[model samples]
Target: MKHLTILVPDAQTSLNTFACIIGAYDIFTRANQHWVGQGKDPVFTVCLAGVSENAVIQQDIMSIRPEFRLSQVAGTNLILIPAISLDFERPEGGNIELTGWIREQYNKGAEVASMCSGGLMLASTGLLDGKSCSIHWNAVDKLKNLFPRVLVKTERLITDAEGIYTNGGGYSFLNLVLYLVEKYYNRETAIYCSKIYQIEIDRQNQSAFTIFTGQKAHGDEVIRKAQAFIEDHFREKISVQDLSTRFAVGRRNFDRRFIKATGNTPVEYVQRVKVESAKKSLESTRKTISEVMYEVGYADVKAFREVFRRITGMSPLEYKNKYNKEGADLAAMS
Candidate 1:
């Protein structure tokens, strides 16, 4: 049987962390039971392993205690890291031994998977260096800042690189769990669990759920002013040249600084601001796609649709249909 060790982190973790740990354990255990019920041997031996035997994580009003400590596990086929708190500095500072242990396990040929913000912990192991990783979209900027060597794919729902798996934000980690089920078991078993847990299988991206709040924490006064200008006039035709001239910076220098600070080009930033505005209108107002597009200063229908889909993984209409309750209700009746 494959040995699956879910790391019970000894740090201030989010409430979702507990859910991810219990949820994964329950699903994997169910998978084993399903196999046993089918006259087959169980596939995995699952256990929750922590840094220390006495480690107890308290979040809000609840507590979690792992069944085994990391030192006791001589070897394991797989290691799972669940979402921890977003105050990554605190966890990284406190969980030095945990990260070191994860590194050792990975070096010993064990597969590691991180759920949601757990990517921060896995990335700390240096196993994800130069490898693609997906985390909660909201934490993308922070992860990028902390681990510049790691390729953070904010759009992907799941990233599998050389046995290191990472997933997107929130309860979307359930999708990654289902993916692990299919990988370790079979498609039939994965489908069975998906039905049992009511999780939508084969979700490939988390872009639709992302709210494009631009990264402004970088201390670049000029870039910050430029960002504010873009946000203030997103409904106007703002060009890179115009922005550069207005800011009194050279074109190349402006582009470089903008990208370094915001992780987006001036044009890209402008598009995102406009699209975000359009999204709000679509969600809250009784407006046609054309009206919303024009309101966001998108004169070209094709251009607007393409950019919207590229950023959000959904067309304007699809986004509206998904997020706008009134529109969905009307469509249902129609």
Candidate 2:
């Protein structure tokens, strides 16, 4: 219920990810309207400044400049770095002026937080010298080598720290913001905010005890194409040869890349996705199991039922009963 300004790197910058975060949180707050300037309850005022950087590590990007910069930021309860490209060479050397401004605000009692590479900018400010922070797993080694004084904690997300907070990566970025809203507002507010925006917030921490479950391997463009194709054709039986030809990659290379990047082979991943789609259908639709199965890539009822049982540990009918039925046994678990 307090107005806040998110100072983004100036315009002409490559990507305004943080500004998007500001806009997203504002929308998530259910503040009655898109936050305009200087309103009574301005949940977020995006200050788009110059100094563009890489949006993601998927490509080799050249940093750009912005048309405006933060003249002065004060009286805000929080400062957030959505993402910053802090590299191995002189990681703490770049972004001097911006980091200094953040430090000045934090000294004035504002809580500083960053998501993904944004922690690099915060680390450059020395705010995380003795503090613990979570960073994108890919940059774990570089970050540690760059800043030995900082205590790096790798997990789903990190917060409730004394002076700062950090999240693991882009997906966890939403979790970080939701956690902030929940801390200042309430759990209901956070949930309502997510629901109103139709954002599938991170309900469970992905970086849990399952070792190698989330250990991110190197990025691969071939796998990206396969994923795109899978998302597009979940209703049909997608073939490995078809994907290989469509993406202009060999079947072996495509399979290797997909498995390396997503931690699941193409076939296995598709099977899981098909089952998930069927689960939603069972919950939200009045269709028969055979129809739902065909709708989600499986044509045989028995095969779909078997996959569902193996993955969810429940048959189709049992899952539907537990989910759609009122006060079904193990309803709490459902």
Say which candidate scores most in TM-score: 1
Error of 2 at 124 (Å): 0.9
TM-score, candidate 2, is 0.51
Please, what is the TM-score per model? 0.98, 0.51
Q: What is the lDDT of residue 77 in candidate 1?
A: 92
Candidate 1 C-alpha lDDT tens digits along 105-187: 88999999999999998888888999999999899999999999999998999999898999998999899999999999899
Q: What local lDDT does model 2 show for residue 6?
A: 46
CA RMSD of each candidate after superposition? 1.1, 11.6
lDDT of each: 0.91, 0.62
| Top candidate (lDDT) | 1
Q: For candidate 2, lDDT tens digit of each residue in 1-334?
A: 4434344543212243543355444654453342322244545543434223432112244332332344544356777776755442443322455677788878888887787777776787888988887887666656776687888775446655785778776556777777767665557666776786666565433332112222233467667767767877878778888888988889898888777577568887777777777777777666767788878877777788787876665788877775655324445666
Candidate 1 regions exceeding 4 Å error are 90-94
